[model samples]
Target: MTRTVLVTGGSSGIGRAIAERFAADQAEVFITGRTPDTVERTAKELGVHGVACDAGDPGQVTALTARLDGLDVLVNAAGGLSQATSDDGSNLDALLAQWHAHLEQNLLTAVLTTASVQDRLTSGSSVISIGSIGAERRGGSYGAAKAALGAWNASLSAELAPKGVTCNVISAGFIDGTNFFHGQLSNERRRTLVEETHNKRSGTVDDIAQTAHFLASPGARHITGQTLHVNGGAFTTR
Candidate 1:
């Protein structure tokens, strides 16, 4: 059976990898990005549908959801460290702006997108949100937002589980081949990140992509309201 999948922020990075993974399985995949050209290009390249949308915006999310009939998998992969800016250049204003951006991008994007598509999620469906290891330590505002994502997922899973829908967060660590650092990652930082991992290697987008695929599989139907860490043992839970 061909599953209908929607992946936000799928033009590149982990989202694109997940979309490609599903597309390979012959799933009907729809990918969204904030930019039209990128989304269209990636959709064409991947042989999937594409829509330009800012997932954080309620109206845009509503419009995006309208294009869907019933969804089998929804990957909320839209999130990143937002640059902080303020007109007055005041430290407090900058701080507030930074926090707001983090929450809006990393947290609210998932919340809004999921809520808008809640009714369309079929029974036995999955909601997979991309998270970060920064949520556990040294994650500042960005981490806090991801942490909030996990918390929200817990509640969301509880609510959706009774309806046969599973929701979970994938807390990823130092993945390579993505513009995650916006070209600001130094060699020293890169080495340190790999060294901190038990595997002694940076994660690949396929790592997270595989995990997302599994979570949406029949085997993972029992798994819900969980935070699955894909950081190569960078962080652990008992």
Candidate 2:
């Protein structure tokens, strides 16, 4: 049977890859983005449904959720670094703006979107969030927000598990082919990042996409409230 999956931030990067992967499995996929052009373009390119909605906005999320019925999977993939900047490019005000943007972009987006779709989720549905390795180190404001996502996922999983719903976060590392670098990653920095990975390579969008597919699969039904690290051993606890 085909499942209906909703992937936010599906216009590009990890989210787009995830949507494409699911669509390849013949799943009925719906993706959302903050912009109309990108969302529409991605949907057309990937052959998935695309909607315009900002995950950070509660009202928009509510409307987006209302449009989705019988959701089998929900992936919170919309996230990014801060766009707000200071004139000097360094200051307390800039730092504060960055923090707020990260919080809203990462944390609030997932929270609002999940809340809006909670009731619409089927019993065996899974909710996945895209996280970052920075949550473990060098993440800064974005990391803090991602850390919160893990903590929240624990509680969310506990709450949803009894109802046969699973919630988890995928902490990704050194992902390439995305705007994540913001075009600022120097060659040396890029090399250093790849060298840090046990695989000695940067991660591809398909890596995370496949993992998301596995987590949402029936075989992964027992897995919930867990943070699955897919960093090629970049930062391992053991």
Candidate 3:
């Protein structure tokens, strides 16, 4: 059976890798990005449907959901460090702007998107939200938002589990070859990240991609409402 899968922020990085993984399995994949050209180019290259959308916007999310005809998998991979700025020139204003951006991009994006498409998700459906290791450490506003994502997923899973739908968060760490750092990652930082990992290597997008694929698979149906850490021992949990 061909599964209908949607991945937000799929133009590049982790989202794109997840989309490609699904596409390789012959799933009917749909990808979205904030930029039309990037979305189009990725869609063309991956041979999947593409939509330009700011997932954080309610109107845009509604519009995006209208294009879907019942979804099997929804991956909320549309989050990162916010680039929002405040022109008010005050510390409080700047702080508020930064926090808002983080919440909008990382937390609200998943919340709104999932709610808008809730009706489309049915039995055997899976909702996977991308998370961060910072949620357990000094993530500041970004971490707080990700931590909120996990909390929301817990509640979401409980609500949806009775309907045979599963929701979970994939808390990733130090993935290479992504714009998560916006080209600001220095060699020292990179080496330190690797050294902190038990495997002594930076994570690849495929690591998270494979995890997403599995969570949407039958084997993972029994595993819902859980935050699965994929940081290669950068953080541990009992």
Query: What is the alpha-carbon lDDT of model 2 when measured against the actual structure?
Result: 0.92
C-alpha TM-scores of all predictions: 0.97, 0.96, 0.97
Error of 2 at 238 (Å): 3.2
lDDT of 1 by residue, 137-232 (tens): 999888999999999999999999999999999999999989988898999999999999998999999999999999999999999999999999
**Global local distance difference test of model 3:** 0.95
Q: Answer with 2 or 3, whichever has the higher TM-score.
A: 3
lDDT of 3 by residue, 74-158 (tens): 9999999876663244688788888999999999999999999999999999999999999999898889999999999999999
Worst 10 residues of 2 by lDDT: 81-90
CA-lDDT, candidates in order: 0.95, 0.92, 0.95
TM-score for candidate 1, please give it.
Answer: 0.97
> Stretches of candidate 3 above 4 Å error?
85-90
**lDDT (Cα, tens digit) per residue for candidate 2, span 1-238:** 8899999999999999999999999999999999999999999999999999999988888888888768999999999877677324479888788888999999889988888889888788999999999999978788999999999999999999999999999999999999986898899999999999998989999999999999998899999999999999999975
lDDT of 2 at 51: 95
After superposition, the stretches of candidate 1 with alpha carbons farther than 4 Å from their true spots are 85-90
Clashes of each: 0, 0, 0
